[model samples]
Target: MFINSKGYYIPTKRVDNNYFAKLNDLSEDWYFKRTGILTRARASEEETINYMSIKAVENAIKNLPYDIHEVDLIVFASYTPNDTVGTTAHIIQKEFNINNAKAFYISSACSSAINGMEIINSFFKSKISSKALLICADRNSSYSDDRDTQSGHLWGDAAVALFFSSEPIRPNEASILDINTLGLGNVGHGPQAVTMEPKNGLHMPYGKDVFTHACVYLARLTDTIIKKNGYSISDLTYFIGHQANKRILNNVCHELGLAENKSLSNVEELGNTGCASAPLVFAQNYDIFKEGDLVCLSVFGGGYSCGTCLIKFN
Candidate 1:
């Protein structure tokens, strides 16, 4: 599969560390030192998951070389869907009048976007669809507890839209080289590490465990995918890890012998935007990617699942 175009939408409301300080008595200096997060994007009442995704598609469609009607598959990868029955994918299909596309939703925590793309790749491989659209968004504020000291300051809201085709459709597009995904539900704290319950809200009782295992799996996935494709760490032009924490990203970079500048990050500004994190980074930095550049996206989500995708600009 090849990437045709990408677009993203981040909420305008910026929540700083002081908000957490006032709400949870966590000092700005302490928070910044621990998480390297100064401010995060928070969505307003109007910026629901559907709204943000629609806006992102609008932005992405502007750069699309083909017509919107060419899309035959629409996948909305989000754990924070506003309505389970009427999902964002269906909404996008309806909004764009893509009456011929198959639409649905999927969730594997933060790794949902990569998994969704993998599904699209499979569909293309099976001759089921030639063109696909992936919309990933997360409204963490909808389920986050502002008073919870553990993760109150770590949530953010954003959305990204990515267009894909089974074959190279345009010049300067990215070609999907390989995709590897793993479900580590039996590893470490697993499901108990991070919880987002309706009654309890989002909490990380085992944040330390999450951080430890995330660093390991993210690095392992990236290393495996790159090596499986016969490339070395130094050959990777850019690395985009799951935007859960700065420390975790640093740990993965260190483990992979990757330099600081080579690793792209958005957690510092967007906090953890759940499934939207990695793709949002790609969309925001799409113009910087040159032809022949090798990019790797590795992600570890709350369900203890991890995945990696290798793409090279063609």
Candidate 2:
């Protein structure tokens, strides 16, 4: 499938490291040295997951190549659901008045977006849909506790919208060359590394374990995807890893022998945006991607999942 249009919405409220420092009694440098984040975006009461998602879709569809009614599939990929029963996907479908579309929600932690995209790929390959909309978003602030020192400061709110078609709708669109995803429920700390209980809020009991495993799996997925596609690391024009941490992404670049200059990220400014991280970076830098450029999106998420997507800009 070809990604025809992309857009994102990052809340305007900025929460700096000092805010966390005061709340957790940790120095600002300690937070930055560990996570490589200076500030993060926090959504307001009005900026719900569904609201941010719709705003992102509006930004993406500004230059839409097809009618909204033609979109046969709508997927909302997020772990922080506004309403589990009435999914954000259905909200979007109804808001846009999409008359004939199948809407659903899926989540695999931060890897939700990649998994959603893979499902869309299958739908197209099976001739189940010609046009699709994938909205990946997270309202991390809703679940995180500012007083918790471990993972409370690692989250930021954001959303991204990606429009896909079975065939290229425009010459400048990017083609999905290949996608690879894995469920690592038994790897490293597994499901115990991160947990979000309704009463306990979001907490990371195994921060060190997550960093170690994320570095390994993200690089592995990126390298495996590139090599299996008969391409070398040198051919990659850009590398966008999961925006969980700048340190993790930098380590992945080092392991893959990819230059840090070619690695693009917003984690330093936006912090970790959950499932919206990688795609948000893509949408933010969409204008700079040149024709024939090879871009790789590698991600690792809390459910102990990792995935990679190789795209070729046309």
Candidate 3:
């Protein structure tokens, strides 16, 4: 089963390039031409991660043919949670009345959902759970500093969910081939602090360095995964990358010798939805997928973490 992304929302107001020009010596054309991003969605102050997750899951459930109660596990992945003390999975479970399933959460920066998929695959293989529902949601806008153009212009809000079942009751068109992860603790040091100051709020990211590392690591790791899986670049139908920046995506495509259209990007429409970005792209384009088509997904973000996975559509 594949998790479908639904109920997409983004902010309407476009922060002009003048904002960046004054703050960071950057321009709108620089962001747009470079990242293929013109705007991103921002959740309202009244909206919380849990609320968005609930709405997204509700939409996904409505689109599904099966009952929600059939799910045996619930896995919610996000770096931004409604609270620090409790797992958001239970809240979703209660909302859906999925009392029989086990609920938990995982955090690996922007790669959380893909990492969650790795774990869900293991659980099903071990017979620990027959089915799992994975949801990736984030509200970066809530943590962003409006005055920091680099980070403000880049961050967006979204929620996406996927359902997985172990039983071969119905043959799936696509199957996960492999998922691999490499932590950049020794290099990027991960997110050491998360603070919202009284005036500026969140700290601004070092855009140049982050973009450099993302392109370099993703290109190398993507090559490694394709080769290790005994597959070539020609085997992939699409390479869905994290919608962090247009330049990074273009650079990775160039490095891999892949065509521009081979990548599915929603950065311009949704900005950086963190872990939700890749799957959201898949969900939006799922209808066009056919059997034997190969899809490669790569993500690199805040944890200074990077991951790549291969999927074959039935």
Candidate 4:
């Protein structure tokens, strides 16, 4: 699908590393040394997941040439839900006053946006819809315990929206060429490493293991997509990864011989927004890429999931 436009919303309350360090009883530098996150934003009570998501889509539709009511489908992605029953996609659709559009939600952890795009790609290829909307939102601050040291300081609130068309709405629009994904779920392997308990309903992720897997697997997944698509490593112009960890992204770029400038990230300043990370990065950086430039997106997170998509700018 051709990307017509995108919109991003990051919470206004910015918390610095010092804030997390004090809570963890560690030095400020320790936050950087380990997670590489310096600051992150937290959503206010008024800025609920659906609120931010609707705001994001408002900006997206405003920027695009299409009407909101004309959108044929909506795919929503989120890891942190504000409720137990209602799907956020349906909420967004109803708020948009769109009754005819088909909508669904995916909670595929951090790789959710990529998975959403994959579904959009298929719809375009199958000629099922001419226009679609994809929204990824995460309000991780709601679920994370502020007093906990491990998973507490590692999340940010964010929402990103993308409008897609089967054909380019503009001559210079960027479009996804392919999406490759991997899900390794052994009987006891994946979710055990990163989980939210039913008893306490708190996020509990094994940081070191997640970091190790993120670096190696994201690198491999990215490389595999590039090569399989007949694009040389030298052909990639930008790498927008999931805002999981700055260190993991850096290591992946280093392994691929990619320069620092070629890799774009917000993890240091925005923490990890789970599913919204990659799309938010893309919405912010897509204009920097020149026509015909090949850009790659790679994301890894819980469910032991990793996904990569290669996009071509026209």
Candidate 5:
């Protein structure tokens, strides 16, 4: 599978680190340095998940050669769905009048989009579908709790869409080389690592523990995939991890002996858009890679699920 095109929808509203610094009574430098976030986009009341998803897909295909009818499937990834009964993917299908395609959702939190890509690759290879649109979107601003300032400061709202095909859609594109996902539930850290209550809708995460765990596990997962695929750390041109925080990515790179510049990080401006973080950062930084460049896409999410993808630019 290869990406033919990518589309991104950034929300209109912006919240700078200063906003959180003042709210949490921390120095501006402290929050910005620790989180590596300067500003984060926020969704307004009018910006629903489905709306952003469709708009992103529209943006993805707008410059491409294919018509809307050619898209046979859509995989929507998000944890911030507005309605439980209404599926965002199916809604996008209807919005684009993709009459023949089937749509669905994935709720693996920050890993949803990466996981969706893995699934779509298999679907294409199996001939279950072709020319699929993968959209990773989140409206995290809607779920922010006034008391949970940590999470409030870390998450933002945005969506990313990508056009994927089994056949080479473009002469210049990144082919899906390999994807490996693993679920290490809770990891004995209990539910305190990350949890969202269904009753009051609060996102509670233990900062220190989550920080330590994320850095260690993400590095291990990336290393595992790299070796399992017979590729070494030096073989990867760019390492794109979940843009959860600048500190985490930096630490992971340091552990791998990988240069910080080789890793694509957009957390400074975009904050962590959950599952949308990695793909949005990847698309935005795609031009930095040379043809045939090796890239590794890795992500660790709330469920203690982590994955890595090895890709070769086409």
Candidate 6:
């Protein structure tokens, strides 16, 4: 598997600490201390989801043994797409000139990329495809309002691409073991179901309530997956959680009996990249991973979706 991230492109607006002080909110020091984020990347108006996705995929394919056309399938995951009908996968395929590859898109909020991983694993195991490209890109900054400090400060835009192949290679570092997912409440019948609102755009979460549910479900599900995989908590060297909030992550880590540093976080630096957060962490820290090291990735977010996966680098 090959993982890569792109776009540390800066944003235009530069909000200061005093501006936040007037809102009676936490200071910059408090925010950075709590979330470990000093700054986040924001895309410019000229940068669209397609542009970022293409750049990310280009970076991911570099230095690989096979050419881009060798990829038999592409699984693109994102909640924010350039258009509702246009598949970003097709756009990427066209950009890379990988005409032989089949393309599909996944739309599961923040856990979308993890969901893509599961899908790629199934394809490889089932003999449907040998090589699959999983690209996750999101432009969450577009939906955010600078005036709404609460939501605006919690988002960033990014694109990440990962390549997974079934062919067994030498120096196996980490390979995907298994994945498990749980969605809260009924898909179409939940109180927290996504609904379109005229003025509000889209509505579902009520802030604190979502935080409570995320903490409880994420903690329970993560523990269950770790145990079910026949691996003890100590076996995992790293716990990569979705970059949502410091409080939620801290609560989950506390419940899991894991150290704070063991859980790789980028919320402070990248805010929330939606679907790109988890893989972005791997891409940024790929150099730190060694052969046989096991990394557990847990993703939880907006679709009321939660996922857990164990990967061993080669």
Write candidate 1's Cα lDDT for 118-218 as tens digits. 99999999999999999999999999988887887888999999999998887768999998888889999899988888788788889899999999999
Model 6, residue 75: what's the lDDT?
87
Cα lDDT, model 6, residue 25: 67
lDDT for each residue of candidate 2 in 176-234, tens digit (9 for 90 to 100) = 99998999999888999999888887889899999999999999999999999999999
Off by over 4 Å in 3: 1-27, 188-201
Residue 234 in model 2: lDDT: 100
Model 1 has a clash total of 0
Where is model 6 poorest over a 10-residue stretch in terms of lDDT?
Answer: 2-11
- lDDT for position 314 in model 2: 84
Task: Write model 3 residue lDDT over 1-314, tens digit each, in one string.
Answer: 34322333333444444565567776667767755767677787666888888877876776665778888899998877777557779888988899789899888888787888888888988988877888888888777766665566677788888777765444553677788887786675345322344555555456666787889888888888888889999887999998898888999999999999999888877778888888888877888888888898899866578888888776
After superposition, the stretches of candidate 2 with alpha carbons farther than 4 Å from their true spots are none
**Better structure of 4 and 6 per TM-score:** 4
Candidate 4 achieves a global lDDT of 0.84
Tell me, what's the RMSD of every candidate? 0.8, 0.7, 2.9, 1.6, 1.7, 3.3
Clash counts per candidate, in order, are: 0, 0, 8, 0, 0, 10
What are the per-residue Cα lDDT tens digits for candidate 5 across 136-248? 99888777763466677888889999988898865777788788877767474535567766765637467777677779877998898889888899988889999889999
TM-score of 1: 0.99
TM-score of 2: 0.99
Model 4, range 33-105, lDDT digits (tens) per residue? 8778989879999999999998998888778887888899899988787765677888988887976888988
> Model 2 residue 116 lDDT?
92
The TM-scores, one per candidate, come to: 0.99, 0.99, 0.88, 0.96, 0.94, 0.87
In model 4, the worst 10-residue window by lDDT is 197-206
Clashes of 6: 10
Clash list (residue pairs), candidate 2:
none
Stretches of model 5 off by over 4 angstroms after superposition: 190-192
Pick by TM-score: 5 or 6, better one: 5
lDDT of 2 at 254: 97
Clashing pairs in 5: none
2 against 4, candidate with superior TM-score: 2
Ranking by lDDT: 2, 1, 4, 5, 3, 6
